[model samples]
Target: MANHKSAMKRNRQNVVRRERNRSNRSRLKTLYRRIDEAIVANSPEQARQALQNAVPMIAKAVNQGVLHRNTAARKISRLTRRVNAFAQNS
Candidate 1:
């Protein structure tokens, strides 16, 4: 148990921070999923749009210390390549 008022306050702050981080991570993951789905569906237009929107979101998460920059770059790279191929084919 938190023995003092300051410790109790710290506990509350930690809880709030954890929830916020979870939400932010969840949002990033959801966008990533959407982009992947569009790519697999071979919809060039949708994939491009999703990549346009997701790029900054992924970068922002990395900037916020939620994701590593290399990880974000790898995801962006693969998604872009997939969408570009779709565009070329269609």
Candidate 2:
């Protein structure tokens, strides 16, 4: 329902960006779950590997502006802490 051509274009761009952001968020959640499950299963090696994969994906999300830098940093910090604790205990 955009009257102006530019507005219509902007709407289209928003739709595309929305889908991309949703996909990125979904992937992030999946990675987080994988890490959590690894930790719960008491597999330090698997958890560490998942953490390795997750950190870069999270940093990429921050760089892409899908996630705020602090939010991403906090997520990375918590995941790292969990993995480290699991490693130490195991």
Candidate 3:
């Protein structure tokens, strides 16, 4: 219910951006969960593989502004350490 034309256009643009950002964020969470599941499964090989897949997705999320660079880097670092530890233990 935007009375002004510009307001209506802005509303449409916001809807489109919201959908795109939501999907991107959802994908990031799903990827993160996959890595977590692999870690919890107690299979180092699977965990390492999942981390490999998740890292790029996380980086892309950062690049897209869905996540901050440090946040993504921290996630990657922690996951890498966990995966490395799992590999060493296994």
Which numbered prediction scores highest in lDDT against the true structure? 2
What pairs collide in candidate 2? none
**CA deviation > 4 Å runs, candidate 1:** none
What's each prediction's TM-score? 0.82, 0.97, 0.89
* Stretches of model 2 off by over 4 angstroms after superposition: none
lDDT of 3 by residue, 7-27 (tens): 999999999988988999999
- The TM-score that candidate 3 achieves is 0.89
The candidate maximizing TM-score is 2
Per-residue error (Å), model 2, residue 43: 0.4
Rank by lDDT, highest first: 2, 1, 3
- Residue 8 error for model 1, in Å? 2.0
Off by over 4 Å in 3: none
- lDDT (Cα, tens digit) per residue for candidate 1, span 2-90: 98999999999989989988999999889989888987887888989998999999889898878898998998898788778888998
